[model samples]
Target: MRLRIVVLFFVLAVGFVLAPRAAAQSPIVVVSQSLDMRFPRSMRFNIETKSNTRITVLRLTVWQNGVAVGARYSPAFAPSQHVRAGYNWSFQSLSEGGYLPPGTRGEYTWHIEDDAGNVHDTPRAAYAVEDRLHTWQTLSNDVVRVSWYEGDAAFGAAIFARALSAREFLAKQLNIQDIRPLQIFVYASKQDFFTALPPFSAEWTGGRMFPEYGVIMINFAPENSDWGMRATSHELSHAILHSKIRGTLGDLSVPHWLDEGLAVYNETSDHAPDDQFERMFQLAVLRNTLIPLRKLEQRFPADSEQAQLSYGESYSVVKFMIEKYGAEKFAALLNIYEKGAAPDDGLRQVYGMNQDELENAWRDEIGARSREISTARLPTLAPRPTFEVSSPLASPTVLPTASPAPTAEPTRIAQAANPAPDTAVPAPAPALPASGLCGGVVMLSGLVALSALKRRGGRDSER
Candidate 1:
């Protein structure tokens, strides 16, 4: 009996030791921060905890718009705790995926929890966001100003030179002069570039451009001049193309297919006859899922698979237009849009063909199904080509756009555009992708194609 009593006592003692301890008394936390979103400037947080009670939770919540995103850390007290949490609107955003790019408004707050079951919330703080990148090192010309970190000054100049060459090419093709003061931001490292994006940005996105500010953000990995120059050229085409259309029409109302097509067309690749885009496009054609020009002109599929088809269709059709019809006639088509001519009217006037006629011609040349997609009959922003599906040549008021001469050494053609379904933008989506384009699945290995089409109907609306 005595042994049993002793055993019971021992068990009780062990249980007592194993039980969770009662909460410690709370500590008093007084926190402050000197947040400056500028380079050659400081960005961090300072917290002062003055209490015997232990801290359980300490975190900084970076608020963008009203949404919160941040990191938690181990708590420290007294002797003036310093947290090196800096704020740079040019780089960090916590609100929405891209709650705030530079030149936007946002707020942030801190939270603390103590062992005493006590919680603390800091007052909301505001940031005067600006284009802090402007303060970075710069290389400029009459048309563009290239911004870069000190380490990438020479690279910045190189891209600037390449951009000028691209500008000449785009202007000649679009038949428009460059007037905008373009600025390209060259991130020395992908990490730096990624850090500056909204949380929702996709991994595939390598660069972005905003026509509003004439801003372009591209990454340069030390010595990869080939990619840097190519990317620079690709983005420059967007700026030039949009500015030209807007200049001509007094509004940037160009269609996505046309806009993206023109951009991809300007891509100069070492592998001149790659067939990736062609195979993907052909697959779509064989599947009988080719998006009719009507559906493609207004908006593209939000699904990647469906979206790839649209990109492929756009690139293919545009390539066909340029090669089949003379570049001058194509320029005239753009001029029609500039004059506020409807797409159908523009086709009829320029090529003496309606939308249907053009669609049929493209389908036949590519050996795609001569039949029209049935889903295309569903509601779309604009009407499909007027030519009947039964006959591709139903309404040719003018001669066929195809060439009669033997094809000059046939080259392979292929590519598809982005199909981001979840990303949302706050600004009017640029009628297309900003060049937010970075997060898109532009899958072609070397083509600066499929820029993430942030269909944010606002701010960055698609073309």
Candidate 2:
């Protein structure tokens, strides 16, 4: 009896240790799962499963390649032993919030639950978002892959070469040691390029860079490869710089001046002068009307002329800093920003000065005096203007102030002349803990919105 008791206790201990494995097993079996890539329109997810019990719940989860959190959808299906589930995810909704750029990759999976309490999960499948309308030729090296449909292999080769050179120049300048792989998709015409972008993209947009996905799309003809090369270098610089600063908490708030400054300055691998921006910068200096660097910390002016001046000043100041302070210090400053330091705080920590001081220093270096501060009396500071009694006989009627017009949407300004129809909204999908180059909400809210600043493609093909 003692021996039997000891054996029974040992059996119970082994069974307890294996209980989780046993519970994890389910009678449901996934027969097959697949994704149909429709490109620029919609992709359908289809799954078939069999179970001894009626399948009560079928859920589908989808996410971009680098992102951790996925959006979950419950595909409607009747409870039965054999279940088929499918959902057609429309790209039309992308115009409202998010986008899946051409060449972007993603994954999907299916979850099954049955009335008998059995559960099963289909293995994850991968899909690449592409432009199915065209047949693209691709050429790649370790750094970047160039794809083009209009040009020959040589056309793709030229862009690939320029991209490699640009990567080299930026890595050396910024002390970037490791670079993530990048994809460049060349669209031969403006219409083709616009097709790849979300519906509401600006009409003037010539090129766009989706840094989170390491993708750049540009519209330039084969004969204009020169401009294409420069644009490639400019956009590639943005991607590499963003990669350096983006962290688990999402991208740090690197000042707009610094971000665009570095990109415009690096347009040429040899550091050739940008004559247009340089001329504008000189004009600003001569007029003593230079924009305060502090003002440029958030955004540049909207007016085209003022925007040009802003860009020129930014390039000049960035160039001056690098030439005077050395690349190591500039790189150190970027590292500080990556750790979440504010613009002034990062500059102060790295160089012991703030935006105003830095702007003054750059001004002095460029033979310009410090920016003047106006001391004019404000309308509020002035005593209320004496009112004449001429209206006393007729009682003056004070008109109400007019409200300001609504500003254009932040970046992707769809042309009003060609408006897309409203799309059917999908049911709210469950969200997972967000993690990626862009965080959960920002990621789905069109991570490519960063390209807005580069949308105008200033001057020639400068995007």
Candidate 3:
């Protein structure tokens, strides 16, 4: 009987010791997780978890909102049974190559692991990295969305209508029907405009495009509707053209001339050249100071006059190609570039001539002398150039002028434009797995192309 009692007591002691161990082995439970998006500064992610054992690892995985892959971060936190982990994502001092644009929608998840080896993954949450300082209203169509904080509904509508027109025009011109959706954020003032862009942005930046993000930003009020429309169309052209040429394997390095030329040409709905741009081209032709198209294959010169002249020359060259060779052949040229053909190589395949020959052809058509060809060639992988298209303050008949009065809207303008959409809808922020341009899918490879436009004052625009 005594031996039986002793065995019972021993068994009870063993049960008491193992009970806690078994409880510790239970699965970890996430109590709560949230993201606080604070614009112009940082985003904060906080998560709380409960577990029987000490929480040893707390990881946060994030990617641009529609992207499949992302980077993982292990936040510093003390080990504890019930723990709260927080991480602050900063907006300051972004690397020139790996910066996220404002209005970038993102997704995040928490990876929690405990000392007992139990793991728990919280459901993914979505957030927008946007300017939260002001209230914003938006308008969207099937292909595009326009967001604004300062403008009235009419202002937003006008921008949205113009964006749609540009989209339709470019789609027809490029023979691209299945275009991804795009977002445009128009800031009413210059201070607000520069606030949204990267710190490295130049002072002359009037508008900017983040193609990988499907985003375009510009600073224009209702009174400057003509420039606003032109700038909007210009950036939209870049975004659309990029979508057509950005390949599954990698982005084809498009020649700066072709890229900016197409953008300037598309500033007007009818694809008419800007008068100021034409004048700049004519002036350069007379002075024999026209920068060779080969040199422009990589980037334009930094001098303000040279930059203006570069845009003018590019516009003239692209106009010549389309009017002479036909739009179908131009579309075919883009296809060749998408297949990874070199700049001159693609031109030759499409036009039966190389860069020099094409330049001579364009020159002859324009009544200008042929440019001298130098043997010097820029590196195959030249530093990505910033393209800046100039938006002269010329009002075209194609786009209606906005009401100069701060409070009143013209009956014609309001009637023609659509109202704001139901919500500030986000477009697909897809990142290529090959390059870390859109989001850091593999590594921080940054965007292959970051283009900007000069305001009316000729601030050195870098596209």
Taking every candidate in turn, the Cα RMSD to the unseen true structure, in Å, is 21.1, 16.0, 13.7
Residue-level lDDT tens digits of model 3 in 1-463: 9999999999999999999988755478888888887666777889988898899988776666423335455677899998988877766533211346676766677777788877776766777777777688988755687888886888888888888777765556555444566788888877787777665555655676666556777777776677678778888888767644653224536787898888888877777766555677899899877878888886666555666677889999999998998877787776666555788778877899888889989899988887777677735533222221111112211222331111111011111121122232222223321222211100011211221232333322223
Q: Candidate 2 residues 1-463, lDDT tens each? A: 9999999999999999899888778989988887787767777889999999899888776766434345566777888999888988766563221466787676676778788877677666777787888988999865688999998888888899888877776555565545567889888877777677665765556577766556777778787776677777778887766655653235436887898788777777776655655677788888988899878877777555566677778888889888999877787776666656777777887789777788888888889988754556423221112121111111112211321121121111111221112222332322111111111001112212333224323222334
TM-score between model 2 and native: 0.75
lDDT of 3 at 301: 67
Among these predicted structures, which one has the highest lDDT?
Answer: 2
lDDT, candidate 2, equals 0.65
Q: Which candidate is the best by TM-score?
A: 2
For model 1, what is the alpha-carbon lDDT of residue 5? Answer: 100
**RMSD score of candidate 2 (Å):** 16.0
Runs off by more than 4 Å, candidate 1: 1-138, 150-158, 198-204, 220-228, 246-251, 269-275, 285-289, 372-463
Clash count for each candidate, listed in order shown: 32, 0, 5
- Would you estimate the TM-scores of all the predictions? 0.52, 0.75, 0.74
Name the regions of candidate 3 deviating beyond 4 angstroms. Answer: 1-26, 66-69, 93-99, 246-252, 372-463
Return the TM-score for candidate 3, rounded to 2 decimals.
0.74
Reference-based lDDT, each prediction? 0.53, 0.65, 0.65
